[model samples]
Target: MTEDAATIPIRPAELAAFLAARMCHDFISPASAIVSGLDLLEDPTAQDMREDAMGLIAASARKLADLLAFSRVAFGASASAETFDARELEKLARGVFGHMRAELDWQVEPAGVNKPAARTLLNLAQMAGAALPTGGSARVRAVEEAASIAIAVEATGPRARLRPEVLAGLRGEGPGEGLHGHWVQARYVNLFVGDAGGRVFADVAEERVTLAATIPA
Candidate 1:
């Protein structure tokens, strides 16, 4: 994406288009695999491949389900209700991360947070889950403050540095040149939290990276 293209004050139509396109790009891969798996299942001559194809189909279905659940809460208009409990987000987070090499340790309370805060928490968890390029663990925690809730997602593993492009995007500096898929989450988190009367911050360390947000009551 160009610097101009990535700049802020992104019109809602354009932002929605971009997110929809990106999400479709992500959704297509597993979905295609599932289709191919079904094709293989129909071929009686390929009986040897049926077991493998069935497994592939099952996994893809799970991923598609996860993507739908995550996208609904993260990008779609949620909060038709006043607040969303942590359990819903936790279930989605576990599904999202389960497909990855990393494990997710969820500590969010049933104590509800508003829709925006919940979205911020889910994005943080997604970002932390991806931070572990190699196999590791990600943890999502919620702390109830006097007037607000603090949401945090921490990833621990070797070579756990926040992507410079993601960090830059979070700071409103735009993702660096040659940016790709990962920059999208950072962009969304920054815009979403700011609009929700919240602040996005993070800590980068050699072994762990934590993305956090403070959302007001």
Candidate 2:
């Protein structure tokens, strides 16, 4: 076994803090853009560039909305035993993916429910979103099992980075290299799945990375 094969449960509080910080960082960019757009809207000559300014404002507002909704499902406190519509979750995943410049190809079942399953899907969506740098397709699907559910994220993109340590962390392994935001996210994903008694698998190659998780029924 190599260093990347060790398994460890990450500190939940720390992982939550990291995610909060990341969300804040991303929100700040669009928030600033919104402020700038507003300032421009108030200008006497703004009417000449009304279309452009309005576009900027709309884009920023959408980004903020996506971030808030996604973060709520990912890090916020919610009932773990409630039933949530799979279609609704799929829509949420699409919203999160919309913020990216990637070409996404997703297929989700009509309707389903399972809080753990929903959370797992959300994590998978976010992780796959990060893997695609040059904008590739991400496909997701879910199936009900005897006493659980299986969720998968198959992504293809240029410059995909699924390092061994990061993969290890996603598999409930020890702390991987924290050099990148993706790796940090992987650690949290690993912990979340592990805590729910689920497992994550990854197959990373030259131009593709596939991640999947199985959660209890």
Candidate 3:
């Protein structure tokens, strides 16, 4: 069946570029902070603030490392591993959540998941964390349901909300007036899930947002 013109998939080149840009946006902040911290440490007149500089450097370094590791599995081709351990995925999710205001609750029932499901879990978990700008909790759950894997993330907080572009992306639509960084991740999840004979869903309510996907096992 032909896709509707308005909901056509993005071109390969465009999608790749958008994804790259989005990852860069995520990394640049902590990378720049590390640099700034180093600059402060080198300033002889600011020796009194040396401890502060070191603290900043250490925290930013950890955050940078965490984001990089999470991105590798969520967005990049994480080697040739066909299946990923659920425990490791939870660690990755926790690493990213440590720096965010939101908390993570990983409750995956499966011991392992295929490539597509792993990516979906990681991306949705991160997206759920993002939904809560203020403090909140993002619960990530995945289980084997017959011949498929069901993944759901519920984000609840003081002001939990899903971005407009994110909804559009999950529906396999373009960003329109939304931010590219947010839209690209959702679109990527949608593409991989659809390719694996699955679908993605998102629902927004007062102080809550839910994201879900199912991938054929």
Candidate 2 structure quality by residue, lDDT tens digits, 1-217: 4534245445668666766677788789889989888888899977788778889999999988987887777655254537777767777778888888665566666377566677778877777777887788888878777787888888887887666656766765654455434565677777767778888888888878898988887
Please report, as a residue range, the 10-residue window in candidate 2 with the lowest summed lDDT.
1-10
TM-score against truth, every candidate: 0.90, 0.84, 0.96
Q: Tens-digit lDDT track for model 3 on 1-217?
A: 8766447658999999999999999899999999999999999999999999999999999999999999999987499989999999999999999999999989999999999999999999999999999989999999999999999999999999999999999989888878888999999988988989999999999999999998998
Q: Cα lDDT for residue 105, model 3?
A: 88
Instruction: Enumerate residue pairs that collide in model 3.
Output: none
Q: Comparing 1 and 3 by lDDT, which wins?
A: 3
CA RMSD per model (angstroms): 2.7, 3.4, 2.3
TM-score of 3: 0.96
- The superposed Cα distance between candidate 1 and the true structure at residue 167, in angstroms, equals 1.0
Quick one: RMSD of model 3? 2.3
**After superposition, which runs of candidate 3 have C-alpha atoms over 4 Å from their true positions?**
1-6
lDDT (Cα atoms) of all candidates against the true structure: 0.81, 0.74, 0.93
